[model samples]
Target: MKVIKNIIFVAIVFLISIGLLVVGNGYDMYKDAISKIPLTEKVETIKEKENYTKIEEVPEIYIKAVISVEDHRFYKHNGIDIIAIGRATINDIKAMSFVEGGSTITQQLSKNIYFTQEKKITRKIAEVFMSLEIEKNYNKDEILELYLNTSYFGEGCYTVKEASRKYFGKEPKKMTDYEAIMLAGIPNAPSVYSLTKNPELAKQRQKQVINKMIEYKYLTQSEADKILEQ
Candidate 1:
């Protein structure tokens, strides 16, 4: 019994050590990611003034679209999408590979901010913890805004606002129905659905977004059809 107790104590200590390391590394990674953002320049300059602010305010439509496509239960979940994680795990085990990831937007943001592009269990664990921290610290809108602004959407664009300008020559808030659908599609796989590279695929993705909007009652079938027609 003494030996068993010793073994359990050692295991607990090892787990605590691992958790601390993961969190420490995650903080470093988050700081690095924030530093690399171009908007950091704007943020710093603004900070010099009395009324400094962050420009990446979360838009209602943006949040709705993301939740509709990525994780419908985002508001309900703590930080992780258990169903997606389970599915990803099952697929990974079946294929003996790590190609699939069932990360929530928060998790993805956490991973992007604090973890390498590596597909490993250690990185994923860190991502989960960081996501939980993010959720705890920020409101949903703030978290969503940060995720949108920092996430890579291919075509060398890091922010939805930049992507909106590049793709539709408008800001996200002013995006037309077609433009919003197109922008929404980019997060799935930007290069493949990029209007410049694959116009047809981009159109298909836009249609998919419109369909989702329709199903979510954000738009009617007629509205979706009209947008598609345009």
Candidate 2:
């Protein structure tokens, strides 16, 4: 029993040490990135893009769909979703790899503007720090708009407006329910879900988005069916 207690204590301390080291590294990376380009200036630059789409300019359904699939608890969380992080942690532990990232829209926005797409613990931590900064400086709707404007939608489309025009030859606000839902899912894995490249996979991903919407009560089963039928 004494030996077992000692082992557990050591393990706990080791884990705490590793956690501190990771967070320290991430803070350094965050400072470096922010020094190069301040958050406010970076966000203003994105919002100034000719193709930047406002939250009101986008379809309500599309916004709901994105919230449902990307981060259902987006409105509830400040900058990070503890529930999502806990679930992702469990999954990653089981898989023994960083397979699932429970990134909130704010965190994704932080990465989009400040950090690389690299999947390192330090980068992830930096994203968390940046996410908090974003939440502090902007409203949730503003953060969502920034995320949409910066997300890559594949086929060289980097903004929601560009993706809408490229995919359906329409503006985001003019998108139909079906088109809106389809567009909402593409950014998850844009390369795989790009309609021009893999129509089947795009449809499959669209179904996933629809399912999430229904699950989140953004749409009923009938509504989802109608969208799919269209």
Candidate 3:
């Protein structure tokens, strides 16, 4: 609960602060997400052509944990989840700030691969369209694979394979459920919840992910508790 409150506060402050720092042309940025996203931008991006990890190569627990927390309705929805957006709207009104992002996994993948992370409604709208386009072109597993292969985990690791090795010195298939949950939660806000920079925050987010897993029926209460115990 405190973690959520803190996130809301931070998001409010960050959004207000970025109002002035909203750099780059919105038009160009919109074009970016709609078109091709560069592979290595000194930051990170999902490559379209090379070294993609197959869905079978990643652990099943990782996929379930990510979908459970990030977007339970990912397989059900076309791309955007209106229910999530409505829930976020309610929370935004109650908080009097736009802290909650009701974006689905595909929408996030859209943002990561297509557009810049500018906090603007217009960019979000563009992301929605691009997300739908991606859904139309790719299957659920394909989208998940692209998302997993492309996401940026903090500590300078852009790809999940790199993140698993760099953070735990293990391959993706070798990661435990707890490790998978922790990694699953990182892409939500990489810098703030980075395990190296803020282990507590990262752990708290992991707990949230576990809670979501339970809520979504991906794991039972005992299973979740056991994972947390580890």
lDDT per residue (tens digit) for residues 101-209 in model 1: 9988888777655567787665777677668777877677666666676666788887777777788776667776667677777878887988888989988887777
In candidate 1, what residue range of length 10 has the lowest lDDT sum?
49-58
For candidate 2, write residues 42-119 as lDDT tens digits. 988998898989889999999999999999999899999999999999999999999999999999988888888988
Better model by lDDT: candidate 1 vs candidate 3: 3
For candidate 3, write residues 1-230 as lDDT tens digits: 99999999999999877753443344445566445643233123344434456678778888988998889999999999999999998998899888899999988887877667776776877777777777877789878888887688988777788888888998888889899899999988899899888999999999899888888888999998888888
Q: Which residues of candidate 3, in runs, are more than 4 Å off?
A: 1-51
- On lDDT, the leading prediction is 2
Candidate 1: list runs displaced more than 4 Å: 1-59, 215-217
lDDT of 2: 0.92
Q: Using TM-score, rank the candidates from best to worst.
A: 2, 3, 1
lDDT of 1 at 29: 59
What's the number of clashes in each of the models?
0, 0, 1
Task: Sort by lDDT, best first.
Answer: 2, 3, 1
- Pairs in steric clash, model 2: none
